[model samples]
Target: MNKKGISMILGIIFTISLAGGVKGIKVKAETNNFTVDLSNQYRNVTHVASGSLYGLSDENKPSDDLLMPTKPNVFTQMAPNGGQLPNGEASPTGDALKVAEKAERSGAKINIRFPDMYKDFPYKWISLDDWNSKIDSIVDSTLASKAANIYAYELWNEPNWTWNAKTSGISFNEVWKKTYDRVKAKDSKTKILGPSISLYDEPWLKNFLTYCKENNCLPDIMCWHELGDAKGVIDVQYIEEHVKDYRNLEKSLGINNRQICIDEYGVTTEEAVPGSMIRYFSEFERAGVESACSAFWFRPGRLSNIITEDGNPNGGWWLYKWYGDMSGKMAMTTPVSQTSLNLDGMASVDSSKKTASVLFGGADGDNNILVKGFNSNKFFNNKVHVKVEEAPWYGVDTKLSQAKEVFEGNFNVVDGKINVPVTGMNKSFGYRMTITNKEGYINRYEAEEAVVNHANKFSNEGASNGQYIGQIDYKDSYVEFNVTAKDAGPYNMKIGYANGNSQVSSQKLYVNGDMQADVNYDSTAGWMSSGKSGTKDVQIKLKKGDNKIRFSNSQNGYAELDYIQLSKVAKTFKVRQEAENALINNATVNLSSYGSNDAFVGMINFGDSYVQYNMNVPEGGKYKLEVGYANGESSASTQNLSINGGENKVITFEKTGGWMASVPNMGYRKILNLSVDLKKGDNTIKFSKGNTGYVEQDYIEVTK
Candidate 1:
């Protein structure tokens, strides 16, 4: 765990027959290095139960209620021919592994989970014995194939239902532990991922996770389900769980490189909302969620997301392909999974000593594990695409030979963190980690070298934003610019602060060492009357790396960084998008921070007036727009939008009606545009507002 944060990266590869070691290839050009090692893949969808794919025959039916196929309580189903779900034949497995081998050849890892549907049966009530028996059956059936892809096992289907509820009297905790322990004993190499909390913010999820930890059931990866991740009727309390937050949570738990995956996740695919799935999937990938499964492959005829149907353009299957089919890279596992090794040898460890047998990449339990780039190379530049063969479990799609590439993205620098993808590639596969550029410009700054700032200075990241660098201290005349521009240098500059009513001082700027030139601090006109009429200017030159400018408040009193301008600056376009309700972080947005009365808050880039948010205007003008519920007065007592600096302008809201929009300007984009009066210099806008109830900000749109 050095400053780089990359430690303990291992590979999971099966030791096949004779030729089993590693195979490798190189691109020859890149410097960062491209390495691909083997890690567990097909760990999710490999469980194959016999005879279900071809359909059961007449003699296999179990005498029961065949009439209720979809009911949650009815487990026994009499087949059309009196057959049980898997009544007919018993076989080891198929050539799917060969396809996996081919996929590996083309730059991807592959595997399949057989006996697709595990918890399709119904059970309203049952004892712990029954649950154990059912789990035993699943494990036995899955192992029957002797296939490595069927290595790890998921707990019974959605437990909230009748069958799972009745079958497992205890919570998923008790059930998963038993299953995990059994699996680990059976195969030490095969890691287990679990307790898939149905959603990120489930009310009862904390208990399940605690159970796992308390019982030493920490999973190799975490799994869970989330339905209609977008449309909010699902009752998820904290809906804005971003990938970074989730990954950070894992890190906080002290699991160095362990992954967090969404075992089951579905985005509303109804064209009703374009990019719904795209945006949803991106959040996890961009945020570094290890893996995500679309809500389900539920009988195509029964639901909207189906991989097989005809005619639809962006159907569920297409999404799978879109998410899966990244050229030679539809498998975004750990970099270990990508390190190609070129070796032609044989090595095997017999399990006769009651040892564990682990399997990874290879064609027919015979190919060697391939690893590439042993040097200090990480081809982190290459985008990752993951493709998981679906299974019969809850409508998961399983096609290894023709696996579709999903999520062809990679990790980029974001706020200085090289955030990478963790999962949610093709649904229902092993966890994946493809570096992405989306995490743009990582920030690993120490406290001394870092200071996070909203445009308006000294204000919380809320609606009540204050003035741009309003010099807090007036007596000490040393000004410090907001660290917006990169690589600001060293120079003598004047800063303003206050000791009683009037005081300020300046200091020579030094980045790493050399002091900057021309230190100037005047007390006569510019120093005494700061922010009154206008402010004075301070200049400095910064080197490439980190530059520090110090301002000393001799008395340690309240000092305001009233105004600061970079002597040498670049052109970075500023565009802010806000919500009518409380939409904080764009990717990790949440709507539960408001009280009953405070349901809305918003932000805007006066410059980009064309792009509206929260309240819209009939005709765009410079009129201020606010978001919040108000009865029939000019201004309701509970104002959704609050301004600092003593209300820069009076925004008379249309007290009544359903949520009205206010247009201060006479016309649309003309004067109403937030950028109506852009002063030549720096502009900082802050936001602050809240109430009793939480806010729900969908978005606010603006146009010319």
Candidate 2:
């Protein structure tokens, strides 16, 4: 075949395969330095629930998956007179307790902050004596509620700046001491956290801690914040370094034992992308910080919310799901460099299940992930399976239609290190890699390798991941698949295609050189949303060994091809019968065998000669019948074929030279396939001579 023909033939050849119905197959290998130790675990992730609870009073918000003991952004601070106290309606502290109760019901830890007795209400300052009265009222009310879920009581918010240092006419130390003494007197059992500073100010924290130590009122949990600037851009490295400095400061002050909580931290202003958030999560885990919220200033439908206004999981929602679903212990995941975003990932392993789940980001090409301490002993020869379901990175619109991309292949593991090769990755897509003890099968072939002649107009993405065939137009333009069937009879052809244009389209199918049928492709959600487009399957018959299948859209139909699959279907067969035994008229029984043990009918030199058969089918159902024949003449011949005396179908017979002739090793007799709906008893089928010319007939085989 010439280049044009070869290209056309190649396009058609790649349209065949075994894809659906196979399970437990691992994907191809990738290279990266993401490794996990199944034996040595650092932190127990199940006990590591953390997140902030901001404006989550209603049930419509997503709060169940985050760590409990969440710090509610609003407690009693928003209510007047601190709203209702346990002492009748005279005081206003019961409103705060009620808010705490709601937080507990929402499966989060109860957290509350005290209001400024003066500024919160009539917008005026109050005397130290008046503050004492309010503090006493709050303590009485809190003691009465007996709400055990209350995790912490923040002394004040942003004491470093939000509270005027020299003015307010009162000192922070004086305010802290009076409230501390009053609350302790009422309920010393409650955990008291202090000086909720807005930023990492060592001088302010040290002064506050030193005074609290002297007065014997040090906070149980030290708290601070890590906020982004006006631009909303947050650097993960900057956050990591600040946290390390905080730890060192704690040790130097002889307060190293105090539990730390950078409760409020965020990388972006209004939008929180999962890739950057996961990096923050890793930093927190490494720094031994307690709980941290995404620092959301607005509610759902806002830029920071994981759930969108339509209630579908937006890009950042899956990250929370993956984090919430993980158990066991945290394994060490070291990237190529601490500053490089290429290998950002967090990994964990469950020894009992022998499964490792790694949530990864920053992948653009082939990378190797080295995993150690897997449960397997000898090499199982199983492939590394990576299932990547990504939502766009918050702002990318195309990623909104993300469908799950799968990559599978075998990998080599020496010693305890299992090196998995992962390829065809787009930057910023969330990847989940799992190493299992169960055996897996490697994918057969890639779609690009089988593509013959795809038009260059359509753009290709995820091509390395076997998802790059597209821009199908016209009937003659197509893709081909050279597929090999281990044992073939009847198979289902599954085609993965996209028609996001919202218009109906179809492609013509050709099996082994004969035009077969047309496969229809309905419009999908979008080109990227393959999950919505789905797979189209059609039943086709294949002979044992290699076969060529082609898909072409000659009618100017519009559709995008992803890949094609062929899965075997169950079939039943009956014995073949000699053609000479059938009823015939102008045809003679040629005893000279044509590769078969039985004799074939020949010498039907005239157009009027016909052969008939009365077949006794054991069951009443649809069955495929194969008639073997040969045409040795220089020119080809056509025969009139009928089933149950139905309308005749003009079947063409290609030239074979002679009944006994074999051009090299190719057989003279070819099988003519046809479908018959037979009754349980007898059915009459016949083959008559046609204007094309004469040919010899061999035995017939029936299968259902």
Candidate 3:
């Protein structure tokens, strides 16, 4: 059978199995065992690094807020004036630089593909002079712009299929040498990466490297594409072998091992499938590949199928977000089966945070996660807190909420090992297992039962409490809850909400008739869609008796409220003070479309203009002082912060694009966290202009 036929058959089989169909087929359901050694640390977590080819159509197509959560490491885009789409239309690379700037702002790198500038898929060969001129423009523009995160310039893209030696009047090897020399001559610091073949071909790579080595034009980074097959079936089962083979080839050629970057990877079918994508992530991290970008198969600006066309996160995005959330050293993980796309996982241990996380999927059924080598005194005592959550695949178009926690409990750590049994695993979903030493008491309150004023209560199958409070668009609309507390202290209040608005929605959270903070909610798949509820946590202070807590739209907010959870936390101190409520000097309190109480302290450009707040703490030594401010200026703004009238410390607030608006069409606010020392009892915190720049202060959160 042809490759297409085989791929089709494989797709059918995968579809059947993914849908949990087993009629007439005897499938053995057995536990897949995996081991995670906390002591055997290999590398630091790369923040779940991954990206896409031509995934960014423009600067704000998907918005930086949407892309920031995934923590993309590198994105491959067409060079200037390139990027011709499959449809005859062109997405021209003119905006590529702007996109790069935005990506860098979001802490992601960029790779520019020179061949994509041709305006054709196979790339109609323009003359050598034309190519050189384009290369010079790219190098010169890049150098002039000073984009530090522009990782590497891909000399060409998929040369095996796009290049024609006979028509170009020169071998592709010579083309590489010419382009490589041109890039270096213009700006020596910029790195050139190439030989981005369509797929892994040993002979092709070996010959290319040999020619480059002899010609003294070797690429700074080796590059290739791993887009399984034409029918979009993922064939990444042997990616480890491919990496090993490339290393051997590099050794035989007497060349030092260079960093490998799979510039483009994944197929259409596997792009949005979290379970299938795990296979790619496992192999890439296992082989120690520097970076990789998900192939843009269907469309641009959707983050390689992690996002939908409607600008909502699919299930796959959540999986990647979980990966990005990983911090500290990556622990060694071994699966029972690794030769094929069976069950596999990656583990990480953040010793400083006293937490360990494992992300596993690919195959379904029951699985056992055996975590070992934990020092009892280091991470846990005899008992450890465990939470297992799943990021379910609800089709590519369906929006998804954050990963749902399926199980939570305290497990005994016997002999530095905890065997976690995950039962009835679904192949389409990716699961996250978090082990932490901290524990807290949680109290849940249904929003529908709260005293609703001008807001309507409605039934939602997806809501945690089966009912929710909605129509909170009016200024007077609110849902209030009167709950009693055992003690007077700070508690973490988690608000479960659903906001289908295009941008982020906010609600003024009130504690006893005073606005405490602004609760921001990102856009979900849809209003009350199953498993699409979003959550935000804010610390609230309550008295020993009854306390009135309310979510009000008095500040131009709109979001469907599902439920509220109050958890008693230990050793954590967080107090939020709104800027509008602060003692202002020469600053004006203006009504804002965003932020707490729909108001902010603006016009703080003068040296004398300041905002001060009096905070009272039970026992304060050192605390994280977070200033929620917005700077719409061209550059970052600075403010002088002082605790208890101490020495003034200059704090820089990065440009937030706009002061009162979320990122263009998305809803995301920025805040700067700084460490400050405070004494017990009453303390005065102040913010004044230490430097010359416009800054709008929203609120300040002091957390210890």
Candidate 4:
């Protein structure tokens, strides 16, 4: 048979498997193709503008760095001195303003929901005079603050269910007009956003807009909510249709067009999943909506759901960060299915930066991204550097290190296009494809090519080389790869492996006969599953010329190895300081049977207790400070970190789910990474008990 015939048969088989809902079936069909037209730039990169309703519960809950990376365009919060949700805590307008300076510093805005000032979830309305007074007070305070980013005053939130016109002795339209007039009377310049309904109801919106237009109280920005029903199922594909309907409504009424903002969107189930959230982003961007906010379903202060409870970036956060990183102008992208929850993507071309980025994912199968009109731009020659990465969804609580680079190399532009194939996609994972004009290096060594000792080579449909080394269950079983480096001081070693065990597995790593860190592999669904392969990265020192890298079972490790990749580390200066070496106050350094150096600092529950480390760095500007700590509490813990005697920065440490006494053997030890700015020379970094819980310190690693 011809190659094309064989391919067609395989494609048919894969399609049948998909129809049967078979798990772990790898598909190679190129039917899910998305085209990116680089020459057609639509709008600036504002798709990341989506924020959350009541996303910020406190002023300092989610640190500034965590919130800044998402580039929130607008956040909806409750009225001042009002947080009476029956279930979870919600950010009030008063405390929300405290973060407005930093949250809105980068052209982001905050929308205030006034009805929440009544201190009831359903909102118990008082007399009309009392409501007017409350509105006046909030308006006066907002005007007095001089906060430029207080974008709009939302008259009410979700009035479809929360408001009662008959009981209040006034119609909702009358109430809206009265509130709108009162707010504009106090602050004429501040924009007013209105009729913030629960969902996109055509009748409700038409009536509200008609009344507002007739009363000469038309909102400066049109606002509504797009949330799932009681079942927590939301179809984001309808966002474009709803926006178009609103535009047509404006034209039919002969009213001036208004900026649209879905102040509250998404549901609990879709908040943290990258694949689900990317569709919302794509739809919102394609519809040219001015701004939007994710609906806060679970915990507040989590930036909708991008952040975990312990203040770590979840898989969804990285996807939004990638969207935030995009600059210049967004290019036109045509997905395979625009109206279905299938393969879709958003692309952007930054000519000034000489880069193009595409973020895509929505289905679990093979896909292709066709980049066209690359030759139309003068920034590209015949060849361009491309790097493809996957941000895997590792549950909400599991702290992920970073996005793994699945493919990286230089690709020649054929004619005026480049077809980038992506395979074995997990529906919950989001993929990022970057094209740059600069050349880079990424060396991948397949495990099957390595010298295997007591290990068997097996085939995997999803593996890069179509084969992997497995059965490394004995202590002596190992795989060693001989690699060459150009000039390496330190390089990032990414181990591609599959561990289907119930718990995390580990493999001892060796570089040139010297033992390195124990690489941890999180559990997957099953062995050789198409979308279940995972990667773990560790920093290792390599010689300039040749190096022998080995991975062996520490003590019956049960992870199958796929491949290992070596890339030049962006941060050169990495320093590890043991907690035992720090100047401990009110804390005891106990000898531990686990972790590095076998000693840790404990008894950090006192208010004045601290462990200070004085160290010098080689020309430091910005560095990542990784705190190794263990908190076995049922809930998350917190600690205060002060650098160079500066104001303390609160660090939330997630519950390790176990302790040294409970699990032992490095199972409870976890690293919390924080970005800090340091001087070129000496600095004193201290961890103290300021609004903190009991935590044991292992060691701190600083890298830049």
Question: Each candidate: what lDDT?
Answer: 0.29, 0.56, 0.73, 0.74
Estimate candidate 4's alpha-carbon lDDT, on a 0 to 1 scale: 0.74
Q: lDDT of candidate 3?
A: 0.73
Worst 10 residues of 2 by lDDT: 1-10
lDDT of 4 at 605: 80
Candidate 1 TM-score, true structure as reference: 0.32
Q: Model 4: how far is 484 from its true place, Å?
A: 7.0
Top-down TM-score ranking: 4, 3, 2, 1
After superposing candidate 3 on the true structure, give the runs of residues whose Cα lies further than 4 Å from its correct spot. 1-28, 86-94, 229-233, 440-704
**Residue 650 error, candidate 4, Å:** 40
Could you tell me the lDDT of residue 95 within candidate 4? Answer: 52
lDDT of 1 at 671: 11
Q: Write the per-residue lDDT of candidate 2 for residues 538-640, one digit (tens) a residue.
A: 6677788888887787573466665555656655547456576688888887533122322467877776687787776658999888877888878988778
Total clashes in model 2, counting residue pairs 3 or more apart in sequence or in different chains: 45
* TM-scores, one per candidate: 0.32, 0.52, 0.59, 0.63
**How would you encode candidate 1's per-residue C-alpha lDDT over 275-340 as one tens digit per residue?**
123333333432344444444222211112322122122222333333332222111122121122
Q: Global CA lDDT of candidate 1, please?
A: 0.29
What is the clash count of model 3? 1
In model 1, what lDDT does residue 365 have? 13
Q: Residue 64 in candidate 4 has what lDDT?
A: 78
Of the candidates shown, which would achieve the greatest lDDT relative to the real structure? 4
